[model samples]
Target: DVAFLLLTFFILTTEFKQPDVEDIVTPSSISKSKLTEGDNTMTISVTKDGRYYFSPTNNPSQRVELLEKMGEKYNITFTEQEKTAFQNTQFVGVPVAQLKAFLQLPEDQRKKYKGSIPMDSANTQLVEWVQNNAKINREAKLAVKGDGGASYDKFKVLFEGLRDIEFYKFVLVTTEE
Candidate 1:
């Protein structure tokens, strides 16, 4: 009885960490170095279908603050409820212009939305998002999680977007081969 109780207590107390971002098959590299997770790290994911998602950190308040700053920069206003929804969001893939509508959608509908922030020469929402987040957290490190099947052009666009903001240093998240 005592051993069973101890086992149950330990099992109940154990914390199981789950991946907050969407699952994407990352490219493999020979390097065995692992990426460390921290509050100062920002992860940007590119899905195989070319959708982009951004997450500054796992902290809700920091994410909200980033969203607020972005809103202020673009002259887009977010309500308290919208701010709360954004705070609870894991990775936002929509452009700032559509963020209000995206947040207003039902959770299931939002998940089904396959839109990504435009990265074209005329549309530089992704670049603006990265720049805004960097301004909010000066010490934050940028990491890119590109899908293994993602096209080179997509990555080129991403690199160009970063270069536009003079952000040359960033880590490419890959798994050991």
Candidate 2:
């Protein structure tokens, strides 16, 4: 039946929101301007504790390539199956060293994986992750979704990381009342 096929198509194509998606309360804003969505946006979610999670783009191939680049940089090799798992992940917060084990977990457990990419001066993995992803898609836009309770200092550090890579402009995800 055409109607059955149509419903199946929609279900297969829809990307379900991750149930354990980062728990962050974005500050409310009244701005009318909106950032364009789709594969062009690369979002970094910051929790109240200042933990940084790199959210992959909606494109699965792009996400896989992004993970590959990160793995190569950290001297960690990811198998084909692990790469596939990484692509399907909603967001990755673990350090490069732990990425392999993180990806190997079952889907439900992967969602429970708790980690954060290092964004400090000594680590700089955060900038590397963004840089590699940007290389994959030159048109990608950067955005930060910070917790409402997160301190300005945490945000300042994140901005500085982006600045080191010559990125000055970015969207701030906010909730509208």
Candidate 3:
């Protein structure tokens, strides 16, 4: 009777949503430290292809979304023609300058952006823009979850970018099973 009652209670309280499956990540055998827990944690995932993912944790149990999801949400897709011209030889990700211009634009305005913003301008503008955005988004944790095959150097760049902007709480994401 008690088990049945508990089952009914759980069924009543449980919520369901589409789950976002993350890539399998094998943790390195380096340091064994106690895990920290708090409301202000950021999640970052790195794809095998060297793509970085910054998953916000504002809503618990919800599918993770990028802070830059705004760019996609607003239909700010970079075309192959543009990306070819925009990318450096590495092709790891968007150039820092381009990232800044994209970050600076208001959500609605981002979709309409056509031309690239110069490197120097993007540097100055992105610093301020990230500072303000991070302040506003402090509650949303910034994370980096990289693929097992991604280069350590690329992860270093991503980490430096977040730290340069004064974002501290980074949580490495991994698949549950």
* Candidate closest to the true structure, highest lDDT: 2
1 or 3, which is superior by lDDT?
1
Best-fitting candidate, scored by TM-score: 2
lDDT of 3 by residue, 19-115 (tens): 3223436455444553343344434445565544332333332211232343354455554433332222111123343554444445445433333
Question: Which residue runs of candidate 3 sit more than 4 Å off their true CA positions?
Answer: 15-18, 28-40, 59-133, 173-177
All candidates: TM-score: 0.86, 0.87, 0.47
lDDT of 1 by residue, 94-156 (tens): 888889999998776766667788787788888777787887778888999999998888899
> Local distance difference test, per candidate?
0.82, 0.85, 0.43
Q: Distance (Å) between predicted and true CA of 61, model 3?
A: 17
- In model 1, pairs of residues that clash are none
| 1-177: candidate 2 lDDT, tens digit per residue | 999999999999997754435689999999888877677788898988888898767788888888888887878889999988987887878888988899889988888777888888788888788889888988888888899999898888889999999988789999897
Better of 1 and 2 by lDDT: 2
List the lowest-lDDT window of 10 residues for candidate 2: 15-24
Model 3 lDDT on a 0 to 1 scale? 0.43
TM-score of 2: 0.87
Worst-scoring 10-residue span by lDDT in model 1: 15-24
Worst 10-residue stretch by lDDT in candidate 3? 85-94
